[model samples]
Every structure is written in structure tokens, then in C-alpha cells.
Target: MTSLPLVFDAPKRALPPRHLADLDAAGRRAAVAELGLPAYRADQLARHYFGRLTADVDTMTDLPAAARGELAALLPPLVTPVLEQSCDGGATRKTLWRAHDGTRAESVLMGYPDRATVCVSSQAGCGMACPFCATGQGGLQRNLSTAEIVEQVRQAAAAARDGALGEPARLSNVVFMGMGEPLANYPRVIAAVRRITEAVPDGLGISARGVTVSTVGLVPAIDRLADEGLPVTLAVSLHTPDDELRDTLVPVNNRWKVDEVLAAARRYAQATGRRVSIEYALIRDVNDQPWRADLLGTVLRREIGARLVHVNLIPLNPTPGSRWDASPRRVQDEFVRRVQAAGVACTVRDTRGREIAAACGQLAATGA
Candidate 1:
């Protein structure tokens, strides 16, 4: 099959200023030295930002006034919340963030009884052109900077700490299943993940296992990520098990077929020992057929092994005016049954923020 004519690169746009989140330990120290500060000041700054979860230079009273002002330039705000919508009794909050360049991205913070999770965007918009997704239909804008991505998590974690989600829980999990195809903006996403999972003061200090990065089957990127040695979960958005329908549903399938994508996921699972999550959006009269469900189990079992994989079946969150709707409850149940009948683990995803458009681009669209 011919490759997709799609250009994975984002459109040209001016980027935001560099921030401390954009720098590694050594890089942060180098930056401080350029400002005539000692190298250890970088560690202090990190402790304030990543550890204490504050960017206000005023709150960093540990530093002399002059040094605080001098170091503050590198911490210029990257993401500003333009609007926020909440549902599920304030347990789920979605923020529409506008970058310094005025480009839009989004993040969602969901609170559970035991843990809180933040879903962050790696790009402002998407180029995947998945007909069922609001972000995909909106098309691509520019990619977010590394700090832009990290700030989303840092802010969400701080919000959770401050009881923005109620009951004051720690933000333990992060999923790159937000507005953009995370793997599309590969480098920044990986760097942001490192900054997120590293120890406090050095990074967010969250465990790497708490992080999950999803892709719509970018074959080469998947193989590359397997070698990163970061044990983050790999989630594959395999909306369909067959190529004929997938080529239409997920345009990238034109370039890499179902088997190719599954093989890459299998490789990642072997490399990381993390169970691969196959994300399938069950849409009515679309990919939710009984046979397709069985085929999904069979294909995943054959390609990625039943033991190393889990099926996360999502009820399609239809966009406004979209023709698509979620499958009936009975159909969804039967589909799950068939997949499980094939000896594969399958379950419906506990969808959050459905009333406020939990799908990534929906809030950004309204905020626009």
C-alpha cells in the first residue's frame, strides 16, 4: 500500500519562550550560570517549581530579590488557562490553554477515589484527520514546546494538590491522550515525560509507570519508544482490527496496516514488560460489530499475546453535529463478551466528563 501523503510536521508558528521545564538538570544550571548565578541555584529553582509546584518568583523568597528577578525570565508562563469546564460533580475538569503565541491546546484532570490523572496535549491541534474526533477534524496547528507540555502536568498536579478536584489527592497518573496524537510530536513528548516522571526537584518525581503515551499506530515511532527504557505504558488507539475500515477511520492506516502497528506494540510490550492497552472507540454501526470484536481479540492475541495486552473499549463520544453515536448498551456488552470469549481481556473504559465534551477538541472549539 502507498504511504500517507500527510505531512507529520506541524505548521510553522512562532514558539513560546524557553522555561525551566524545558531544561534538564545540567541545562538548567548552565542557564543560571549565564545569568551570573551559581549552579546550585538551579537546584533551588527546581525545588520551587517541580517540588513545591509554584512558578511565582515572589513565592521563591529563598533567593535574593535581584537573583529572583534575574531567574524569573526563564520561567515565563507558557500555558495560560483561557477557560475551564467541569462536570461529574467537579471531579473532572477540562482546561482550554492558550500558549504565548495564542495557539490553543487542552488538558483534562480527572479525580478518582484512589488517584488523580491528567491528560495532556503534545500539540495544539491534530493532523490525523480521524473523522470521529473533534480535534482530528479541526486539523493541525503547531506543535507545543516541551515546556508547554510539561506545564500542563505541573499545573494539574498543583491543582490536585490544592484540592481543585476536591478531597486533595496527588496527581499520580498522566496520559498523553489529549488534543493531539502525542507520538506525532515525538521528541518534546518524550522529554516532557522525562521531566514528569523524574525525581522531585530534578523532575515531577512521579513514577514512570504512572505515565502512558498513546499513538494512532505510528510504526517507526513505536519501535523507537520501545528502546527508550522508560517503563511507561504504551497505549495503541486501534479503533478497528481490520485494515479496510481502519484505512478510512484512521487515515494513518494507509501508511501502516493493522498487523504492522500491532507488531510494533508487541515489540514495545516485550521491551517494557508493560501491558499494551488497545484503545477501541465503539461507535454504533461502525466498528462495534460482533465479528470485528472477535477479530480484535484474535488479532491482538496473535500479534501482541493475550497476556501482554488489555482492551480498553471506549464508547464513542460524538462531536456536535457529527453523524456518529455510541453503540447500544447491549451491543457494547456483546462486543465485550465476544472479545473475552476469545480469551482476551476486554472491558469498557470508565469514561469521564462526557457531559462537558471529554473529547479533547470539544472545549477548545467552544473556547474559540
Candidate 2:
């Protein structure tokens, strides 16, 4: 047989210089000073970006006319919207953002009767290497800056306030479940959380309770997050109950076993007094077997009791060329029943954004 060459467009490795939100309060002051502006201007700029959620230099009228232009120039737009595709007639909008380095990521803004939620990406691509995920298939691109992440919320807020979704509304919730494993990008993710929940005239001022961070069970990261003193919900993506399957479904599980991961989650719950979210993706004839569900319920009830856990079952969203598919309705319902039977609260997550490649990595792959 003749030798063959394998080739494809190699993934981009380097991301652009860090955004302002990537820095902490002290770091922001240094950056502002480096820009030749007085230290006080850092707080002023933060007030505009984090508090007022505006990056337009023209609209930051609080600063001196001379300084506003200089400050804005230093902190230029970090995330630019490439496209906003809406499905369900203005109720759901999926936005594709092109970062400064041309790396693309996405976020979904959903408007409901009681709340408006935005699902934000922490990285342009994922490194977890999960076989069925759209983003994981793309490989790791780069971690997003804190400002890049916050800018997504700002844009969503702007859209909500401007009647983008029928009537002027406020962004009520934010979930870090879109692209990369948020805990893997720990530093920047925590910084973004601070910039998000900080008080008025300083940060976005969104309630900590309304923010949720999803991770693939990075144990140490989970424990550290609990100490941050922010009451945001923690969601662990526990696709399978046993280590045998999780080792393949979530590559990180290979490093941290199922028991270790669940223990970490329990510690977080105990420390934070907030119920941890257990996310399980049900695949037909795969992890959705009724026996597996029984085992899962046993693990949850034994490892983390009902008081500290709520299971959210996500039916697999079939990606192009993937062998995976969602479980049949009957199997799905039975799995839920088994878990609930074990006394762990369980419910099926609402499937959305399917019509527009709304899943995290789908839009980037299509655009590429």
C-alpha cells in the first residue's frame, strides 16, 4: 500500500493580548497607568464597562472629554458580534462573536416569561476531548479573556434593555456552559465572576445567585470556587455514574475518578450551602440504560444526598458525523423516574438552539 498524507487546517494556537477584564482591580490600575492616564481613571472606566455595561467612548461622558477617548482607545472592543441568529421568533437568540484574534465563540440569549438568561462561553474551543461534543471535536483554541466573557453579558443586557426580545427586559441569569470547561480556565473565569457580581458603579452588579458555573468535575477548582464567597450555583457535568464510562465520556474523569469528583462536589455543597447541579447527557442505548440509571441514583443518594443535589438530564444533541443520539422518550422518562425514585430531584433540561447550530462548537465549525 502507498503511504498517505493526512492534512487539515491546523487549529490556531495563539490568542490576542489580554483584555482589561482579564485583570483584577490592582492589575487594572497598572494597565490604566501604563496607558498614561491617572490611577483614578481605572475606577471610572470600570464603572462604565462593569457598572454601566458600556464600552463606547462617546457614551462615557463622566470622564473628561480628553481622557475618555484615550481610555477607550486603551480598552478597545474585545468581543465583536459576527452574527445574531434567532429561532422561536425572538424568544431565543444565538450570537456568534469573533474575538480580536479571529477566534470565534458563541453565546445564547433566551427570554422567558419570568427571566432572561445568557449562556456564555469561557473558551473559544474545548480541550476536554469528549467524543460527542461539537466544541470538543474542534480541539482547544484559546481561553477567552474576562472582558471578552463579560462583554457577552453586556451585549445581551443592551439587547434586552432595547427591546430586542419583544419588550425591554433585564438579563436575569448567566450560565457558563457554552464552550470550554470553565474550571479549566480557572483564573480568568473567577475574574469574570468578580467583574460580573461586584456592586453598582463598579461591576455589572448581577446577583451572585443568578450566575451558574458548569465544570466537568475539576475537584481542586471546585473546592477553591467554594471559598470565593460567591453564592453562584455550581453545576457538575457528570454524564455517567461509573468511572468506567465516565473515563471515556469525560476525559478529565481519567485523572479524577468518579468517587473523587463526587466527593469534591459534596464538599462544595457543604461549604456553599447551595445545591450543586448534576448534569447528565442521556444517549440512546448508551448511558441511558435503566440499570445505569438505578446505579446513578444509588451513587447520588449515597454520595451526595437530595438536600445538596438536583439532577438535570440533557438529551444528547446529535452532532454531524457523531454516533450519538438522544435517548427515546420512554427510556428518558424511565431514567428520570429511577433517579427520582432514589430521592434525588431530577428533571429533563429543555433542549434549545437546535435549529441554528446553537450548540457551543457547532456555529464556529460551520463558520470556519
Candidate 3:
């Protein structure tokens, strides 16, 4: 008789203590009460962290000295930078962060004339397993807690305010396009989104519209996010239009397929009245052909039709030892021309941070 399939359980580590940043206002109040502190203490902490954008705890002079230590212990630093390397004359900085458990993640801060943006990771590593992506190659370590994710933005915001990027400009935008798939870490990412978009003395007070969350077509999660009413831009990473190639490029395609993803994008647009962004990574001789770009436009136009969908074409930044390479300039331009010819907006992404291992998984390779 054939033996049954073997069962092997993966070992699980003890999850870290939940931080106040991970909790909403009500939840924070509940946690403070559970910690034997008065409910108003939660509001005080929120004001210090969210309003003042400081979490040193020493600055929280409102709390008694005796109680400060306990509160600080409970709200210990969630994301500590191991090393910070910058290129472009410090205009672009990439940070390697060590979490409470020493699991490493990376975020990039880019300064622009109009606005500054921070690209934060949603998971410790990625599980998408896109052969061309550096982060995907590492596989997923674990989902980062909401606080860990938000703290990256918080620090970047603080840096921007402190003139880290030439002149002070607030962190005007945030993108979840770092190491891991944002949708894969849905719970924490959603919580982080709430903490980011809510009004201050509770959140960073950034407009919900400034936040962009990219997903590799997790349809159910996409649909659920539409109902959230936060009005954040939803970017769908559609590497290729045809299912056969996408099946290999994005393995999740086998389950949800292209039509389903576009349909979900439609749902998101309808719900939030926000434009849905299509992210296509143009790889040489792989996905950058003129015909594929035309097809992408056709599908997006037909499926979602003038419902505010734009495409951001990224030149594939192949990791070390990877076979993929960025598309040539001629091919890249032709692809953009074809997509725009078909009546859908498309543009190449501004390349940044290539000098200092700009790709997500690169920094952790040498050392965490």
C-alpha cells in the first residue's frame, strides 16, 4: 500500500510583544488599562508619538518618572537601523533595519523636488518567489508587526523633517514596494495603513491618498481593501499581460489569473474613486515586447475602461547572479508608445538607489 504523505511541521518562534503603534486608539486605551495605567495615558502617549513625531519616552514628561520606565519597556524600539548607506549625494538613502528578533528588512527614502517618499517593507522577506526579484528569491521570513512597518516611515519622516535630505520636506508619500508582498501581510499592513492615515494626535496625519499599496494580485484581499474607505491608491503589479508568462513571473497567477485581478482592480476603483496603478517590470526579451504592452493596454482598457488606471513600467533591476536584465532604451520606449497608443497611460519608473544595493534583499546578503 502507498504510504500517506509525510507531515512535517515548521518550528515557530515566540511572537514579540505587541506595541502601542500596532493598536488603534481604542485598542491602545484597552492596552493601557490592562497595564494598570489610566485610560488617558494612552491618549498622552499617542499625542507624543503621533503629534510630536517623537518616541524617546524621555520626551514624554507628561508621564511620571516612576511609570515612564515601564511604559518605555512596553513600547521599546520596534525598528532599529543597523546601517544606513546613501547614494546620489545623500538624495537617496537605503536603510537596513533589524527588528526585535534580529530579522532584517530594508527601506528606501527618495527625495524629490515636490515630495519625499519612503518605500517600506511589509514582511521580513518575500514569498512571491518572482525569479527576477531579489527579495522574492529569499522567500518569506515572517510578517512584520504593524509597528515595525510604521516605524520605518516614522523614522524617515523624522529624517526628512530634520533636513536629512538636503532641505526639510515632510514625508509626502509612502509606498509598500520594498521586500515583501504587502497583501501577503494583509493584517499588519492594513493596521499600519490605519495608523498612517488617521488624523493626529493619533497618526502621522498624512492623507490616505498619499499612501500606495502594491499587491501581486491577491484578489480577495484587494476586494476587501476596497471596502476600507481609506481612498489610498492601489497599485497592481502586473508583470505581464498573458497568463502563460505571468504564471511563471507571478506564481499567484495560477490561482487568481489576469481577468480576476483586473476585475478586482475595477472593484477597488469603484469603491474608492481612486486611480488603480498597474506596475509592469519590463525585462529584456522577457516582458518588454511591443505586442505585450499593447495587449496589456487592451486588457486594462476593456476590463476597467477609463476608471482611472495608470501603468508604471519599471526596468527590471536584476539581482546579482540573476539572468534577467533591464530592457534596452529603444525597446522600453516602444513598449511605452504601444501602451499609450492603445489609450492607457504608461511611463517608466525613475530609477533610484542602484549604487547601494537598491534592491530589497541585496543589503541583507552581506550582513543584517
* Lowest summed lDDT window (length 10), candidate 2: 1-10
TM for every model, in the order presented, reads: 0.98, 0.93, 0.95
Displacement of the residue 243 alpha carbon in candidate 3, Å? 0.5
* Tens-place lDDT digits, model 3, residues 262-319: 9999989988889999999999999987789889999999998755899999987777
For model 2, how does the per-residue alpha-carbon lDDT over 204-260 read when each residue is reduced to its tens digit?
Answer: 888999999999887878888988898999999999999998999998888789899
Q: What is the lDDT of residue 329 in candidate 1?
A: 97
How many residue pairs in model 3 have overlapping backbones?
A: 0
Ranking by lDDT: 1, 3, 2
**Clash pairs of candidate 1?**
none
Give the per-residue lDDT digits (tens) of candidate 1, residues 158-265. 999999997888999999999999888988898999999999888999999999999999998898888888999999999999999999999999999999999999
Report the poorest 10 consecutive residues by lDDT, candidate 3: 1-10
Clashing pairs in 3: none
Model 1 CA lDDT for position 182: 87
> What Cα-based lDDT does every candidate model obtain?
0.92, 0.85, 0.86
lDDT of 2 at 95: 89
